[model samples]
Target: MDAKETLSGLPWWVKWIAIPVIALVVFGGLITAVIGFIVGLLFKVLVFAALVGGVIFLVRRFTSASSSSRGDW
Candidate 1:
């Protein structure tokens, strides 16, 4: 039987509310762990980008200042 036909007799709450609640209860820890891991990964990536950018900025500023003082380019 098609899924639509099978679920047609069920109430709306069972399809929307109850099913989602049951799924969350069953997989809440897994879901929480996945989200936490994603957040942590994004935070680490942001930190890495900031540090790299700072290093590049400082290097360019110092290099340009020294080169300009030397009268080259």
Candidate 2:
């Protein structure tokens, strides 16, 4: 039979059982999303730290290089 015929044949208890199962599935999806968000935040923090550190290193190198060149002249 087609899906509509199969659903219509199911007893009332079938619908009741479906409710809690659907709720559990939805709750699982929400938990997965929260975990993914936390992991993404950690990755962003690491990337930001690396970028800031690189900029500071570059600025220090440029300042030291310029100061040494001026003394030589």
Candidate 3:
């Protein structure tokens, strides 16, 4: 039988609720792990951007300060 015919033969609750619940029960751990990995990757990318920006700020500050001091040397 085709998918549409199979689904039509099932009860409404079975189609709407039971299938989803069963799917979650079967793959919940896998779904949670995949979501966790994506979140972690996003967090690490944000941290990397923040660190690079901080380094650039520090370099610019020091360079300007040293250039000003160069005239006194």
**Tens digits of per-residue lDDT for model 2, 1-73:** 8977977878877767985788879798888899999999999999999999999999999989998989964
Q: Residue by residue across 46-69, what tens digits does model 3's lDDT show?
A: 999999999999999998899898
Which residue pairs clash within candidate 1? none
lDDT of 1 by residue, 1-73 (tens): 9999988999999999998999999999999999999999999999999999999999999999999999967
Q: What lDDT does model 1 reach?
A: 0.97
What are the TM-scores, per candidate, against the unseen true structure? Answer: 0.87, 0.61, 0.88
**Which scores better on TM-score, 1 or 3?**
3
Model 2 residue 69 distance off true place after TM-score fit, in angstroms: 0.9
| CA deviation > 4 Å runs, candidate 2 | 1-26
Off by over 4 Å in 1: none
Backbone clash pairs for candidate 2 read none
- TM for candidate 2 is 0.61
Candidate 2 vs candidate 3, lDDT winner: 3
Candidate 3 yields a Cα-based lDDT of: 0.97
